[model samples]
Target: MAPNSSAPHTPERPGTPVIPGFAHRRVEVAEGVALHAAVGGAGRPIVLLHGFPQTHLMWRHVAADLAADHTVICPDLRGYGASDKPAATGPAVYAKRTMAADVVALARALGHERFALAGHDRGALVAFRAGLDHPGAISHLACLDVLPTPDMWDVLHGRDAAVGFHLYLMAQPPGLPERLIAADADAFFGHFLDLWAEDPAAVPPAVRAAYLEACRNAVPSIVADYRASATVDADDDLADRAAGNRLRMPVTVLQQDWGAALGYDAAGLWRAWAPDLRHATVDCGHFMAEEAPGRVAAELRWLLAR
Candidate 1:
């Protein structure tokens, strides 16, 4: 469905940091669901998806820079930020497959049938799925600081898996995860915001507060999003893997030396899924878009060139 002008406009929270000139919009991508996005720039379009515990604002620096030439879109994935968080009535609702379709629908609703796609953290999972499921719709793909779902599960075992303990925490069946997270939403979500960034000041106080606020209000949907990953999302990836589905477009992956720390070849895993791939290790932390926006933007420009 196309964007519904009738859909209520979602106002930015007061003092919420924004991409200088980007406009906020609420675009309905499915029945009773609309994604909140910050859209700006004006040329070939590229959509940027945010990761866990962060919103479109995470792309503020990169989006503004990209807007100089390319139309840049940064959206709160359905369950995050100000986006509508319909109850996860079933598994598919919060699955990356569904979120991937939401991205494609969002772009089309804004008048582009095909556009480049990039995602960070959880968003990267969605972009990965989008590239596999809607190969013709996504012109280029860039993933930051994450592994594919099945590979992510495969890599974690023994003491090494402790780094991702939250994955196990949130993946539990519904009630307990939601209750535990909501009990101290800030502490739960803020833990990642604090731990993931190499430069803590990169996120600053105001933006961090915004993220915490968003996560606090959307705990259930957030857990549902993660829960979907542990179940349906992994199932989807397994099916894709068995069928040998690969991303057909030019793909770029940027990450810190996770392979060294996690005891896996990150690039090799990405190469199995993306035949046309360029994988590099960055010197910064997980929040590379915030910590090193210039390099992230440059890499995206390179991907667009291909």
Candidate 2:
């Protein structure tokens, strides 16, 4: 169900931010859907996935730094950024498994059989699934600021769950979430951009405007993506945990100290899934790639060497 080439591409909106050295591409990962990726550099490939409320642009700093050595491919996840927003006909359409498949396909399409992978927030979930479901294709994995879907649900209770209110909102049956979010997409998406950054200046005015614009235009698909996480993605993670499935690749996890606030060991939780894991708590906010690109890039280089 690929889109008609005649249908003018609308995802990469006018005034959308761009990474200076990277070349943008609309690569078809599925029959009908093409992912918008910013690719640059050479040598070994390392695909970087952007998180929620942001696009490949979030990786601008890190991607530029990594591109100096490794080939860095930054794609806006399917339902976000400039990528196709296929209707979520079923949960699988937006499931992490499916998204992971898209990532593998995108890399293979770019001529890389296997690549190191890293993702932030929602993208981390996709990278996690890619590591588990496509173990042979991912050489190394790094997840920033997110836990496995089931572990996330398990760890939140009472007031602690307030931090994830949007998860519950989006988890509800369709209609309402999309309507509510679309009603004030800017405020809804901008809230996180404001709330999650440790250094507000890290996300400059132009980048912030770009993120808001992307989210404003993508309310439905974005909601579907989150909705799948609460249902199918959670089920997938639980099934894997029950079957003792673990990531076979070398793994690195960088997260804020949610453990202290939420009463769960973030590193311990990640270790259960990634046997060879290196988890560290960072001082920055949720947008670590933008907030501390140097540290993030150094950690990635270390992971690549392993």
Candidate 3:
């Protein structure tokens, strides 16, 4: 299905507007799946995908800065924010392959056959899949604060694995995880915002509230998305590895030195998957885009230049 071209290019939700100078619209990427995207500027197109527990609003600062010289497109990934949260028919539904397809179709709907792609956290997983699956569609790729699913699983062993407890929690068969999170959604979701941020104040009150609300309302879909990561997503990554498939485009990764903490060579692991790779460790916490937008934007520019 083509994007709803008739959909007004304005913020779909009245209470929470997108970044200033940007317009919001819902683009139908697949049947029964439409993504809410905030678009601005005009040059080479760059799609920004937000991480977990946050909406496209997380890109407010970075998007605004990039908008000056590039068409900045920020979309809340499927099952996130205002996007359609279809009930999971199977684990494959929320696989990164499906999510990546949603992004490719979204860019094409906006008249961009090939564009730069960047994703933070969960969105980074989708961007990784896009680079591997749709290399011809994504001209460049940048992933913020995440490793590939296979690498991620390989590195988790002791205390380091516990740090990602949420991964194991959501990876469970689903019903219990959904129930537990639903019981106290705000606190559960807010824990990451508080724990993973270098500066909690980096996320404004209004923006934080928006994230909480989005997560609270989409508990089931969110859990299902994570569950897919453990099963189908992991399988896809392993299959690619077995086939000796690597990302074809120039890839840049910005992560918060998980290797230093977990005692693994994060860069080396990434190098195996991306032959043309630029991996750097950032000083900020998980939410690097929020804590260090300037640095994130600089890295993105470098990726695009490469």
Candidate 4:
């Protein structure tokens, strides 16, 4: 399945914290992959997944705010932040399925067998797969600015092709996008970071600098993530479709109504995979998590209470 044409986006979660925690740190999740996990507060767990061109730092505001009430575990997905980027044997390594596993493993390491999840942009894709595969662990699901794997792919392959050029380019053999992207890292990745944002002024200078620096440094891993989506992810969706499994948790998706332009009720499409679903159109652009942190936080609390 193809990703939506929406610009890729991540952090700066919410208000001040109560318990005074959160010193930047790292942990070795796998042989070489040192996942960056920010742990704060104590209670039932809420694991956050950050979007592209950013990292766990994207959840800084939201995670810190949430940490006051519940244990918040925000990790830089494998190959994203200070996380180790391993050499890939194939697409499976960078596939969302694998990324989902990283989240699952990270949660287990943090002593959470059951937890709630919320993801943004690329992080949402990883969270979607995690919910489907590990239904028992993810009790509540929230996705920001994305569709399910199959529906997204279906939309991308047809009339809205131009909107998702990154899918085709990133899907290419390694070295191409990495080389080109690494050249003008800021302008390349920053284009989406700047464009998809509804309020550019909302993104503070420090936050903006952190995002650009991370994307520029992790071009190969980032490209591998998209590449795996094109190859292994395509096969994964086809396999899941053949098996006919749907998410078995209450699901909330807030996104731009690309459905109007792409031709389909986006919420209706989501119902095919999520039995319990609620969909809404947000006024902001692709980076809903960053643009509307308070609204996003309210929605997460809404899902949590549900």
Question: lDDT tens digits, residues 148-177, model 3?
Answer: 998898889887688999999999996999
lDDT of 1 at 125: 96
Q: In model 1, how large is the Cα lDDT of residue 20?
A: 85
* Positional deviation of residue 116's Cα in model 2 after best superposition, in angstroms: 0.3
Clashes of each: 0, 1, 0, 7
Please report, as a residue range, the 10-residue window in candidate 3 with the lowest summed lDDT. 1-10
* Candidate 2 residue-wise lDDT, 71-137, digit = tens: 9999889988888899999999999999999999889877898999999999999999999999999
How much does each candidate deviate from the true structure in C-alpha RMSD? 1.4, 2.4, 1.3, 6.7
Better of 1 and 2 by lDDT: 1
Give TM per candidate: 0.97, 0.96, 0.97, 0.90
Please list the C-alpha lDDT of all candidates, in the order they appear: 0.91, 0.91, 0.91, 0.78
How well is each residue in 1-306 modelled by candidate 4, as lDDT tens digits? 111111111122343221237654455555555566777877778998999877777776777678778888887888786566877777888889988887887787667889999999889989989998899999999998887766777787665787888777888898878888888999988888887888886667777777787777788889999888777877887788789988899998988878887887888887887888888888887877777777888888888888
